[model samples]
Target chain A: GESVGLHLPTLSVQEGDNSIINCAYSNSASDYFIWYKQESGKGPQFIIDIRSNMDKRQGQRVTVLLNKTVKHLSLQIAATQPGDSAVYFCAEKTAGGFKTIFGAGTRLFVKA
Target chain B: DVKVTQSSRYLVKRTGEKVFLECVQDMDHENMFWYRQDPGLGLRLIYFSYDVKMKEKGDIPEGYSVSREKKERFSLILESASTNQTSMYLCASSSDRGSGNEKLFFGSGTQLSVL
Candidate 1:
């Protein structure tokens, strides 16, 4: 039973501070990793994704770091704002790439 | 940008009733998936269809069935739904562009309550 899990279930950050959410995956051969942000009453939205070949990839205000050696994935938000408060989860692309297994998720709360 | 749309935002049903959850994607994606989300449980795949009239059972496909009559539409059906089936249903689609890493676009999700 392969699984994806997060180091923390919840995180609180002061507005304007940087935030880091971590995830650990069991599948070593998993090549694709994705981060999703889900807000209240809304579906999960794509934040960023990184392939196994890349150590890090940057988006507008977020960076996805993939440490394939340790089977660890992280999402970092720069200058976190109140709007950044949401449930964030990590997913790994499985065999055939059609199915995805997701982590439990970390609830990010940015306090002003 | 891709758009995935679920038929309903919220639905209420009684025990033993049949349920149908509809999903449509405008991007003409080859892959469509149905997943159920629960608190602390994350997203569990129920079923997925890769092409028209073709389907595959996902991780937790016990009480569910799926239909892909058209390229853009995928449907999830529950026969004699139970109370335990109450959960938020999410529909997603991705391109089968041969890349191992698939970027999925999701619908708003249907919050179904089985009473």
Candidate 2:
């Protein structure tokens, strides 16, 4: 379950269930995509990243899918846990430039 | 691996008092940035420096200034703190070596409260 906030979206999921968070990027020319996770009192940590040339990339327990056609990016988490509850955001960067554009981010809440 | 350290986790200052926030990175990254995060605004870049002595203003630079006198340190200065300026400040750094080096490492952030 997910609720839209005034500025950020909230996603609620049960423990042991799979979760998918979606983001619609603004730039079609962006070549790199990244997913970051920020906890309650910590800075954002790198979760996973996918290049434009590739369609999907998988980490230990997370997967990132990139769709250049629609400028959409998604992060899939398997077997959601309480530790996985955090704010997830999408970021994009062009190949020739260093500036990265970030999405508004979605807050994931895990219900045990 | 890439550690960006901020001097303070929480700060309280009086209005009209000059405040300085220090950030240090050990990665020797060429690009360093300062951003402010709010409830609705997300992360807004305040200033960025691509070199030791060079800097560029980001989206919200009013009432804020930056100094990058050293390669590993970047400081954000508020000449006169205001109540409206109270927010979470984040410092980030990235490498300018070449393509595929655009991942930004961020500090834990400093929550500033101005009264």
Candidate 3:
């Protein structure tokens, strides 16, 4: 059974500090990874994504780092703000697969 | 923007009642998925359709069924709703151009409560 899991259930950071959310996946055949942010009562929103060919991908204020050897992935949010408080999840897609497996997610709290 | 729209934002039904959750995507995506999200359990796929009139069961599809009569519409059906089945249902659509590289576009989700 291939699955995706998060390292932490919750993470807290100062408003001006940086935040990192870690995830580990079990499927070695997975070729695509994505990070999603979900606010309370809303569906998960796409934040950033990375392919197996690339180790790191950066967005406007977020970065996704992937380590294929370790089957680990991380999302870094720079300059955490109050609006950044939400639940973040990591998802993996296997090659030639249609379904995406999602992690349990980590709740990020930013304190001003 | 790719839009996946769920028919309802909130729904309430009694136990043993049949429930229908409808999802429509404006984008002509070839793939559509239905997932249920619960606290600490993440999103569990119920069913997915790759094309019209074609469907496949997903990870947690024991108590659910699906219909994809039209290309843009996917429906999730609960034959007999139960209290344990109460959850937030999410609908997503993605293009079939890339095998595993397509990003999912999700709807706001429908919160269902069974009593």
Candidate 4:
């Protein structure tokens, strides 16, 4: 069975601090990984993605790190703001398949 | 801009009633998927279609069925809605990228409550 999960269910951060959300996956053959952000009443939005060939990928104010050896993935947000408060999820895809599995989301609350 | 739209933002249905959830994508994507978002469980794929008249069951597809008669439209059918089926349903589509790693574009989602 394939299981993707997060280390934390909820996290609270100050408005100006950085936030890091972690995920652990059980599928060793997963070749691609992605991070998504979902706001209240909205669907998940793609943040960043990294392939197994790459260890780190960065976007505007966001970074995703993939540790294939440990089967772990992480998303880091720099200078987190109030608007950044949402549930973050990490998804993984095994090669030679069209399916992607999402991890239990980590809810983040930003204090003003 | 890629756009995925679900037919309803909110729906209410009674137990044992048949329900239809519609999704339309304007981007002519080759792949469409239906997923349910629940607290603590994340997004669970219900079904997916790669082309017209084609569908494949996902991990949690036991009580659900799907239809994809047209390239831009995908539908989820619940033969007899149950209270357990109440959750946020999301629609997503992705363009064909021969590389098999294209990103998904998702709809705002439809929250359904079964009483």
Task: Please report the candidate that would top DockQ against the real structure.
Answer: 3
Q: Report how closely model 3 matches the true complex, as a DockQ value.
A: 0.78
Per-residue accuracy of model 1 over A37-109 as CA lDDT, tens digit each: 9999989999999888899999999999988888999999999999999999999995466888999999999
DockQ of each: 0.73, 0.49, 0.78, 0.69
- CA error at residue A86 for candidate 2, angstroms: 0.6
lDDT of 3 by residue, A21-87 (tens): 9999999999999999999978899999999999999999899999999999999999999999999
Give the runs in model 2 whose Cα sits over 4 Å from its true position. A1-8
Looking at model 1, the pairs that clash are none
Q: Is candidate 3 or candidate 4 better by DockQ?
A: 3
TM-score of 2: 0.93
Candidate 2: clashing pairs of residues: none
How well does model 3 score by local distance difference test? 0.95
What shift in Å separates residue B3 of candidate 1 from its native position after superposition? 1.3
Q: Write the per-residue lDDT of candidate 1 for residues B30-64, one digit (tens) a residue.
A: 99999999999999999988899999999999999
lDDT of each: 0.93, 0.87, 0.95, 0.92
Instruction: Give candidate 4 misplaced runs (Cα > 4 Å).
Output: B96-98
Q: Please, what are the lDDT tens digits per residue for candidate 2 over residues A1-112?
A: 1111123388999999999999887666778888889899887788999999999999988999987887778999999999999988787777867566667778999999
Estimate, for each residue in B20-99, the C-alpha lDDT of model 4 and write its tens digit. Answer: 99999998899999999988999999999989999999989978999999999999999999999999999999874655
Each model's interface RMSD (Å)? 1.4, 1.6, 1.1, 1.4
- TM-score comparison, 3 vs 4, better candidate: 3
**Proportion of native contacts found in each model?**
0.67, 0.29, 0.71, 0.62
